[model samples]
Target: MAVRVLSIDAAGIDLAGVALSRLEASLRKQAGDPDACVADFFDLAAGSGAGGVPSALLFTRGHDGRPLLSIAKALRQLA
Candidate 1:
């Protein structure tokens, strides 16, 4: 299987969040799944500095195996 990876490099800028949100939206449209989790597409994810915030939000799993927020959701709060 092909391994998909994602890397977030946020410098604490609103543009970063906006970009992430847009990316997730595009992925959803391409996959024909509006409710898709962006993280589900990636086998590996990494980030640094402020980027870590979104990386965690996208990849981190909760008790029920869900993240705290989606990329679009985090955009509103993070950006």
Candidate 2:
């Protein structure tokens, strides 16, 4: 498995109290893991935001020798 990395920007979404909820939903829908947990899979890192918007860096390594980067890239493409 290879490591995967992704950066998300939540600047103008104005989701109010649903930011984390929305992110979890997106991760579940896109990653095909209904039980997706940020702490379980991703390593949170500092991310640069565009226009000073909030941003986050998510990184993870694939399990069982799979490439996490490819998985993340594929999911993004599908999304």
Candidate number achieving the greatest lDDT relative to the actual structure: 1
Off by over 4 Å in 2: 1-16, 45-79
lDDT per residue as tens, model 2, 1-79: 6664434553532341145446656777788986564434454433344412222212344575333433333234334
Q: Which residue pairs clash within candidate 2?
A: 1-65, 1-66, 2-67, 2-68
How well does candidate 2 match the true structure in TM-score terms? 0.33
Candidate 1 local lDDT, 1-79, one digit each (tens): 8989888886764767777778788888999997777786788888878787778778877798766678877666664
**Model 2: ten consecutive residues of lowest lDDT:** 50-59
